[model samples]
Target: MGEVTINNIQKDESGILKENKKINALEDSVENVEVDGEKYDLTIDGYINMQESEEYTLFLRKSTSGDNYVLTNALLSKYPVEEEEQDELFLEDGESLEETEDLKDTYQELYQEVLKE
Candidate 1:
């Protein structure tokens, strides 16, 4: 007589045997976020706290996707830093303003009106 081995498994919708396991939300923690094998840096821009439900949510923004935002759990530690400001450059000494013929005529009329005042 052959011995029988029993496995605590069930077939899924696809007919594949899958082991049953318990999933606990408190034990789950996000270690790192990545897309296409590249790590994505998300910045915490805002937050929402629901005292009634005792839930806290964090809003994050990514520079790669301008103006787009993402929401994640408050426990996430990967936050973005403020970007540095760039200096502005004005016209040089040799640079001059370009005006069209219509603009020149309008400016002359305005100048005459101002002089009369």
Candidate 2:
């Protein structure tokens, strides 16, 4: 545990700033973790869901926040996704190699589009 900083803050309402009893509290909730004689701050950046399973997921942050490099329980991580895998059409068993290649290309294009956004 670390120290907490309390600062006076003003509230904003409809473009107007008013001084109120609000306090901006900054708490150092981060824990210090040690590995191989070295200590590190275990800060939570964020989390990510498993690509294909809703019950499984991963944290996308640094090597801290408990089990850093492992797939954590979705519920424990507090960032579970309702759906893990994106809906994708499967190629038929008898599909030609060219068709499969075309499908791959299409998937790549859609993935790129999503990344752009």
Candidate 3:
């Protein structure tokens, strides 16, 4: 294969599609990437375990630098999260009671919208 250009390509189970005029087309393109002089493959499959526990673990795979580390709950609580990235820090799974309550509110709002039909 030739060097993959930074083009807006889409692919599904079939293969890569250069032209996707329709909406909701799959954009799955796995490739090897080099970050901080270390080589790592950007895998689309199983990137995030949706069925797994709510405890998110962010890791830098195959890092040559010593700074590559995993971000656990203990480490997360130690540092004060910046105000700007609040939305990103919010839990998508909502494992705790407080988070669950917020998720419930969002669910109800979405339900109401669906029922309007």
Candidate 4:
């Protein structure tokens, strides 16, 4: 006869997870590095509030689907940063609804008058 035994083990519950409103904001910190006779400071964003034991590496490359660059790193510099535009989308309140309707009617009447002219 064979002996039977059961053992239970618990998993580690410590790790970084993605949060909806708790995204890590990247800080762009460019510094010049002397390589041979030339000096260059890479434009990149530094990670904020990251653990020290985490192992990772930053990557600099062009996006596969678009013409842009991205930087990925943790602390001091890390993550992809893209060039984008900030445009507000809204309607202008130059005229009220009734005034706008009147303007439209006036435009039609003006077109008729011009035709007569």
Candidate 5:
């Protein structure tokens, strides 16, 4: 697996309130994202292993401990980026990527939010 530098996003006051709104209905929408760092530990699920030199599109979230990052889910989160093998969804089954629209949307949107920092 290649190393990808992560950039952390600190929440603004509005962002924090947005999170609270989810639990208390304080905001109409959620726009905040979890922070990341250049280097941190990775917590992976045992269903598959990441290999060196392979390109992947991974969706990661900060763990509750606020230290290491969590791979969103085992199969659905780690996407192999090889153009030829793009047809393959996952090694085994749970749900296809297309089926996880909300997750993809969450990560995609969060990623964009992070980039704004």
Candidate 6:
């Protein structure tokens, strides 16, 4: 087992929680931060979309038996900006995900099958 570094923890003037942490390799696995545009993202279920320039107040809990931290209340712990306040971050002139009907789906289907087992 290995450990990652948690450096700084503070809040911005807008009350958004900010953290400076370095992801280190766990066991033999390599780790790094994922950045899209100007935003940082942590892969959750490998399906949740990461919005650029989005801010959230994340409530996290460190694992009692491992070197990991997870959202305290699934997604309820991470509250995004109000819809009105998020309008600018999503200016129509900037980047966007094109509408598509076909795409890869992960976990959800398999989870349903497993549940029926």
Question: Each prediction's Cα lDDT score?
Answer: 0.28, 0.32, 0.30, 0.31, 0.40, 0.36
Deviation (Å) of 2 in candidate 2: 38
Residue lDDT tens for model 2, 1-117: 211121222222333222342222222223346789887644332212222223211222222544223223311322222322323322133434674466545644554554343
Could you give candidate 3's per-residue lDDT for residues 14-45 as a string of tens digits? 34334422222111233446899986645332
Lowest summed lDDT window (length 10), candidate 1: 82-91
Clashing residue pairs for model 6:
none
- Writing each residue's lDDT as its tens digit, candidate 5 over 2-87 gives 23432322343334222212121011112223447344233321133555566555565545654344555643555445532322
Per-candidate TM vs. native? 0.17, 0.21, 0.20, 0.18, 0.34, 0.30
Looking at model 6, report the run of 10 residues with the lowest lDDT sum: 99-108
Q: After superposition, how far is residue 37 of candidate 4 from its true place, in Å?
A: 41
* Model 2 weakest lDDT span, ten residues long: 1-10
Which structure among the candidates has the greatest lDDT? Answer: 5
The per-prediction CA RMSD against the true structure, in angstroms, equals 25.6, 17.0, 16.9, 24.5, 14.4, 13.7
The segments of candidate 1 whose C-alpha lies over 4 angstroms from its true place after superposition are 1-99
In candidate 3, how many clashes are counted?
0
> In candidate 4, what are the lDDT values of residues 16-69, reduced to their tens digit?
322221223232433456789787555322113222443222333333545333
Cα error, residue 16 of model 5, in Å, equals: 14
**On a 0 to 1 TM-score scale, where does candidate 6 land against the true structure?**
0.30
Q: Candidate 4 — which residues are off by over 4 angstroms?
A: 1-96
By summed lDDT, the worst window of 10 consecutive residues in model 3 runs over 73-82
For residue 66, give model 4's deviation from the true position in Å: 39
Which regions of candidate 2 fall more than 4 Å away from where they truly are?
Answer: 1-96
Ranking by lDDT: 5, 6, 2, 4, 3, 1
Error of 3 at 19 (Å): 17
Clashes of each: 0, 0, 0, 5, 4, 0
